[model samples]
Target: MPRNNDLNIILGDLKSLFSIAAVLMSAMVVSSLLFWELRSAAGFIAGMLVSLIIAAAIHSITPRSEALELKHAIIIAALAYLLIPAVSAIPYMISTGMSPVDAYFESISGWTSSGFTMLPAPDSIGHSMQLWRSVTQWIGAVGVILLMVTVLIRPGTSAYILYQSEARKERIRPSIRSTVRTIWKVYLALTIISFFILLLAGMPAWDALNVSMTAIGGGFTLYSDSIGHYDSLPIEIVLLPVMIAGAIPFAVLFMMFKLKLHTMIYDIQVRTFAGLIATGCLLLVAQNYFYFYNDLFSATRYSVFQLVSAITSTGLQTTDISGWSPTALLIMSIAMIIGGCAGSTSGGIKVAREIFLVNQIKLWLKKTLLSKKAVIVIRLGQHKVVEKTITEELNEATLISFLWILNILVSIMLLANILGPEVSLSNLIFEVCSAQGNCGLTTGIINPAISPLAKLIFIADMWMGRLEIVPVILLLRTVFRGFGR
Candidate 1:
């Protein structure tokens, strides 16, 4: 591709993203208008204008090119993801009269699919504003996948390579664009189905709409207490399947839809994801039996819900896990960190990576017992994984897991230092893990009462976690280089 053409392609992507942002802003404005929130409508308009100006300026100044280097693609992806949240926060600030930091924090949390809330309560916020929050998550979840497919996918090869960097390597279709469209279609269909299901379960129209959006997006509901407010076991049961559906890999869903039963059954990632959920649920149930609830059925219900919530990164809770035993809390935290399978709406390191790492370890142990003349190869499913690929995947998984541990440790110490020694260190770590994994389950630590600095730290962790850290790091590197120049 010609240099000029490559730049043009990059510019085109920027323009396209800006156009999408403008559309989202318009949705917010229209929704606000319906709810008679003129202030929010105006803010939406202002945000759109700002985004357009920035996008146009970048497009005009940047050279047009047909192709871009992988580095440029990574830089652009990171910057665009960061910029959108910052711009989206304008309406929140204007509508809710929140401080700039709080607005940005909320916006980042929504876009990153982290369910943490700094708002006083959902009831206090305007209907339009609440809708905007849910809408932002719905859009963000789809937008993240779309951006990965469109801008990051190089020509001639499927974008699976770029997808892997985002911890989503599965392909639902032959082409990146097709895969994106398919996922969007499935996601939209599920959202609609979930909306009606909630309505049928007797939730009001507004609640149904908001919950559906959050459920399908693998996001937390707007209510401060989440599903606890419903006080309806039927509603909770209805939401259970929807959250699980949201966490399922889109590629596997597509295969199932296409009647590829064997493919669905044989998928390594899907089986592993299911197994992890089962294992986590069993442990939590056992804890409930020994401590919280003596009734088996009641204990099982809450345990399964909590496990699903953490594994899916949806953050909806039926009961408080803070009061649970230490072993239970630790198990749930681990579930949060592992999260759902890759190529799903859920976030975190992902079960696929975990499975891969475990299989790699087993292979390593076997290799130590092999004879010198033996030729052995590590395999996943039907594919023969090269030693290099195995090593690379293992290294990436280890690095990410290590960082998660380090971040949790740092956050605990910071929170303890600020909140005093009375705070439980384990609970603090759980909160940090919840925010970083976008799991949203808290041990009652995150709230309006928390200090501003701690809130900001959690917000930053959410953003870094959502982007899987690399893009944000690259953006910082770019800034430092520019300053040096």
Candidate 2:
């Protein structure tokens, strides 16, 4: 009876998810229609129909039992990541003429905010498709679950579970629903302001809007060369703060609404992130100036923008990553692994995790010097962290970091086996790390020509990275348990 009830709740949650997806698809259909892409519009509308039908069927069959729990939320969140992309791929398959695998890969990339593209010439894909890509990333940036929480789900345990399951660790309000709504509003305001700034920076209106969406999500590009297409310092300067904002905790930004500038400045995660970026920028500038480019000005120009992009996990490249020196690549790779803050659109192990790991390491060494009889408590940020809390966090961070490194090795091996001797080891690592970190920077390896197996591996990496691995792990355990039973 318990198993049956859990199944019913899962189905009901999925029905709600699909219902929201239908609305999203309807908007896409309208956008396509506005662009006179009748076939593409029809494809999107068809997907909406399919979503609605499935949602309706689930609603009609499933009993109206609110047997919701954290497990149900975890399952629903995992399934949403899996299934939403499947439905989203329909337009790509029908209108873009991509294979099912490639279409699914593109959808997953956009939905995960990973920004890896299978399409070689994104500009050729038409305006609606471009807008669709941006829209997908924008929705994904905040997460589909968070969207449901703000606009659909009521303020309750279910909303809270869904929020945490999506790896959202920050709340700006007491109520989960109110918190999500506030964040969404902040997200919208930032995106709009960025759009106009880009426009004033001389970008076309459509491109501005699209880039604003992608940049705010820390997601993909419309052009093949990414932000490099503009080649305007003013444009990159305008985008810099937007990308930084996307990488920051929404709660910090919310505090700014109340004019808590001191909190924003003194926040540990923000301070650490800013310091890392500054130090990395200096290192890369010197390295590039001495070894890669003779002109210090030219080196600083490229180094600062790329470092900001990488550290933010925005992945909007202005310079060619393939040509960067090994030292520069290493610096950028470390930044990608550390990523942005705890509750940001950017992905990685995250700055918060790294902060915990570093502080814990310091505490360990201090204990080695202290007497056994002494009592010591470590402080993180402004709060006193107990030994047990530090130990648990250290364990969690170590496990997640291990998984990240393990997957990087696995991906490198897979790419070597599949793509052969032509692909350099460093380039493969860069590509793999970019995928797993949900950073879109690439070494010119990602494209349609890659094997379906490689694309699938990247898709899995993006999914795991975005959820920070726990929900996905729990989901797998749930599946295995069901099978065992």
CA lDDT scores, all candidates in order = 0.77, 0.85
lDDT per residue for candidate 2 within 226-325, as digits (tens), equals 9998899999889889988999899998888678898877799999999988999999999899888889878998889888888888889988878877
Off by over 4 Å in 1: 1-16, 145-165, 382-388, 482-485
TM-score of each: 0.91, 0.96
| Cα lDDT, model 1, residue 168 | 56
Best by TM-score: 2
Model 1: per-residue lDDT, tens digit, 1-485?
22444445556666656766777788878888998989889889988888888778877777655454554555556656667778888888887888877888788888888877778776777887888789778866655536646644355343543344454555677866677778888888889999999999999998899889988544557677888887788998999888888888888777776788787668888788888888888888998888988999988988998889888988888877788877788888898889887788888788878877887887788788998666667878777877678888898888777777787788777778887776787788788889888878888988777788988888878877787777676667755563123
User: Highest lDDT: which candidate?
Assistant: 2
RMSD in order of candidates: 3.4, 1.8
Candidate 1, residue 117: lDDT: 77
